[model samples]
Target chain A: MEYLLDGFADGLMRVLRADPQVMLAAWVTIKVGFWATILASLIGLPVGFLLAMGRFRGRGFAITLLQTSLGLPTVVIGLLAYGFLSRRGPLGFADLLFTPSAIVIGLVVLAVPLVAVFSMTSVASVDERVRETALTLGASNGLVAWTVLREARFGMMAAVLAAFGRVSSEVGIAMMLGGNIEGYTRTLTTAIALESMKGEFGFGIALGVVLLAIIFVTNLLSRYIQRS
Target chain B: MEVFFLDNVKFRFETDLVLDIERVTVSSGEVVLLTGANGSGKTTLLRVMAGLLTPEGGVIRYKGEPIIFGKPGLEHRRKVTLLAQEPYLFRGNVLLNVSYGPRARGMNISQANEEAEEAIIKTRCEGLIHRDAAKLSGGEKKRVALARALAAGAETLLLDEPISHLDEENSKLIVEIIKELAASGITLVVSTHIPEWASTLSVKNVRLAYGRVV
Candidate 1:
């Protein structure tokens, strides 16, 4: 108990002193989460809009599949990504496995379905009257889509923010694909896991605090954006 | 002279069948009235004519060639405008909403602003130029919606019960605006049942009935 107390005190002091490892982990987590989210949003947002707007023979079925995929396991995604980056897999030659890039790939995969699921509901909920109004006004399809998307932006941002939260806090994929390499693949969550395992309770507890702070900031920002 | 024709049209919504019509035609520069009790296919028929809904069975020919749907539908869309029964001002100021279409079509900022100013004047909404469109009153929102339509250069105005929720005076003003738009060579298809007001416009009338009830 005394050792645990001592570690906690040490971790607090380290945080107060601007420890390099603590800052580096936080920075890497932000970078990986941001880039992966952006890529996922670019792909997921338009695909979601198309899913909501365009009709096909099996759209209901496809939507069901997409919605189901939103609950996909992070470990499974990591494993699947691991295969692609492994020596025997398709892109094995690039030697990307167990690296930050691999971690980004995992995060992107994990974020896509999440972003799509929310954006789909957001886009679909747009009033048909607005669309009819835009159409009647001679606005093109692109313009109409833009209008609908704009109207649903608050909801869509919530979805994107949720994806960011998922990736930021997830441990399984980052540990598996990123390998938690020091000064490179190390992230807030992975560092927490690693420090906790090494019995460095103070550092892990400090990271946990930082993680909570990031989540709070993200939540506040998304809510603010939605309200505006 | 017919800008559009909807013939042998039939539309159904899931278990509720909505529209069944043999033939209808609207010539250019004519203000038309679509009226019936609520649940009549007035809105549905307008949707079909505007090419928003595909009739289960019908031919909608615009300009002699059977109108097909595509990005080209946007071209016709640019020519016709529809106003919904409710006012839903988009997020932005009045000036932004009025100029949104031109900007989307790649109009220069200056040109879009100029056109938007002209539309605000035309819709008599110049007073609300800088106000938040999303915060406007029912009558003001409708007029702003009209200004948006006007800015897009739409010549055919399709209004769905424009006065459904307006005060008596505001409703009367909207009716007067419809008459003026008709006189200015813009086609107006307004859906309403106030015969007192309907009689005042130089308009052709069309009535809607439900698929089964009537």
Candidate 2:
């Protein structure tokens, strides 16, 4: 137990060294998370608002499905993505399976439902008075929606952050779809798993610590943002 | 030059009739004070004038043509604005909050600033122009609401409980401004429980009770 504790601390110190390999992993995580978040927001937030506010035939069902998808299993998502990207599947000519692109695609798929559901919930929570006041003031449709989003801006931000957090630390999709290729598709989580299997306890422990700290900081940021 | 007409207009909220106004005419440059007990459709009538609610029956006319309740409504939206009971200020500074409508209507940034500044000065809220609109005091928010309405270049203003949080001095100042605006051909409709606001203008008093115009 003492040896294990010593090993864990030393591994954390090693991972915190900011060397090229660790830095590379960190850079990839940031890049992937940022891109996934941007794409999710662009595609999901507006659609979610429309789904909540706009009258449509299947709105209720769509909202329910999105709500249910919020708790979707990551491993099941990985399987679905793998099946679609594998040979003999849809557009298999592009050969995206086991690539970083495949990992990103899986992450985005996992994220959109969360973004959409949270955005819808947030838009629904805005005061109805805001829309009525805007209409009474002669604000156009665009302005009305604009005012709602601005008033509920914090909720939209939460949706974005929540989606980012969901995708950033997810390992199942990364491992299955990315194949955890060294120096390429290998993410922090995937690398931790691989190093642990190879009995490189220090590297695995270090990566785990970084991931935990990131999750903690993200939670703190979300709290601070919601408060302000 | 009656700017608004409610000929036997009726409005229902859920199943209850909220407004049953008959033959109410608001002539141009006239200040009409709406007085009523609480839940007497004061706000509802104000909302009808502002085009926020559709009357169950009858028609409201602006400038002799009927209001169709479209995106732009009957009034020139660029020049007609309403300040509701609790003004919904956007997430921004006072200057931006005041300038939004004008800017959206194609006013240049500098022109919007000038217009917003003029409006802020008009409402004596210039001191709060650089302050955050979302965190303003109640009276300050009320004043900012007036400035924002004025910023729309509206020749007609419908104010609901505009003076609710104001002290006597500021209310008097606001009344004077309304009178001056009336003299300059701006139509005004102010709804309040207090009666004295009617005496300040070339005004006609209308009483609403239990959703009916009396």
Candidate 1 at B170: error in angstroms?
2.3
True contacts kept of each: 0.66, 0.38
Best-performing candidate as measured by TM-score: 2
Worst ten-residue run, lDDT, model 2 chain A? A18-27
Tens digit of lDDT per residue, candidate 2, span A33-130? Answer: 77877888898898888987899999999888888887889899999999899998795789998877888888988899988888888899898877
For candidate 2, the share of real interface contacts preserved is: 0.38
Q: What is the interface RMSD of each candidate, in Å?
A: 2.3, 2.6
Once superposed on the true structure, which residue ranges of model 1 sit more than 4 Å away at CA?
Answer: A1-9, A57-61, A88-90, B2-9, B14-17, B22-25, B57-65, B69-72, B101-106, B208-214
TM-score list, all predictions: 0.88, 0.94
Candidate 1 structure quality by residue, lDDT tens digits, A71-146: 8899999899999999999989999998888999999998998898789998999877667666666667777878
The DockQ scores of all candidates, in the order shown, are 0.53, 0.46
Report candidate 1's interface RMSD in Å: 2.3
lDDT of 1 by residue, B18-46 (tens): 88887888898888888888888888777
- Global lDDT of model 2: 0.80
User: What 10-residue stretch in candidate 1 chain A is worst by lDDT?
Assistant: A129-138
Point out the worst 10-residue segment of candidate 1 chain B by lDDT.
B205-214
